[model samples]
Target: MNMAVIGMIAGMALAFAGYFGGFGAFLLVAALGAVGFVVGRFLEGDLDIGDIFRARDDRRR
Candidate 1:
């Protein structure tokens, strides 16, 4: 399965968690989804750790 798709589905699962488990569960699931997304991006070579905190250097704006 595509990592992006899996991340989206995992994020959506928070809706069900909210419905049955409450706000805490929703938040936890949401966090997990975010972590999963980052991990997936890292694994897929789409995430650059340095870039996450790097200042924008673009001057074309």
Candidate 2:
């Protein structure tokens, strides 16, 4: 499915979850979804482990 369709479906699911399961369940689902996205990106070679925690560098004189 296209991104828009997928997004609509996900939005509906989240709304149902929030309505039926309340705020905690909504946050749980969101967190799990974020984890899944990260893992999928890693598997797709679009993300690296260090990318999550790596700090930026800056030099000043």
Candidate 3:
């Protein structure tokens, strides 16, 4: 559930929107984004790992 994954999903949603149009596509994108964000947060917390921007290992050193 990385941001990159979410972005790719969002791109998919847009592609769907282009084909399907309107509310359903928007909702699908929203759901995908939310799910991705939650999964990303859960993984980060459970694994004690984080993105470089948030990890700040160098600062700690």
Candidate 4:
């Protein structure tokens, strides 16, 4: 669905995890959510694996 609804659902999930499962569970949910998001993007071809691993130029002054 839309981003707003997705965001709301994710928020609710985190809230439930925090309330019923504690901080560790909250963190676990958050981390898994992030991984899922990335995987989804990758699967959708919206993200390139090389983009994530490409090194940045840190020598720019």
lDDT of model number 2:
0.82
Q: How does candidate 4 fare on TM-score?
A: 0.92
TM-score head-to-head 2 vs 4, winner: 4
Q: Tens-digit lDDT track for model 1 on 1-61?
A: 8979875777679878999999999999888877977887988999888767776884234
Q: Flag the better candidate by lDDT, 2 or 4.
A: 4
Give the runs in model 1 whose Cα sits over 4 Å from its true position: 1-8, 58-61
Write down the TM-score of every candidate: 0.69, 0.79, 0.42, 0.92
Those runs of model 4 whose alpha carbons end farther than 4 Å from true positions after fitting are: 58-61
Q: Is candidate 1 or candidate 2 better by TM-score?
A: 2
Candidate 2 per-residue lDDT over residues 1-61, each given as its tens digit: 7989977877887888899999998988888877987898999999988777766652221
User: Residue by residue across 1-61, what tens digits does model 4's lDDT show?
Assistant: 9999999999999999999999999999999999999999999999999778866763232
RMSD after CA superposition, every candidate: 3.3, 3.4, 6.6, 2.9
lDDT for every model?
A: 0.82, 0.82, 0.70, 0.95
lDDT of 3 at 40: 78
Per-residue CA lDDT of candidate 3, range 1-61, in tens?
7879867877787777757878787777777777776687777785334443465666575
Model 2 CA deviation exceeding 4 Å by range: 58-61
CA displacement after TM-score superposition, residue 10 of candidate 1 (Å): 3.2
Q: Would you list the clashing residue pairs of candidate 2?
A: none
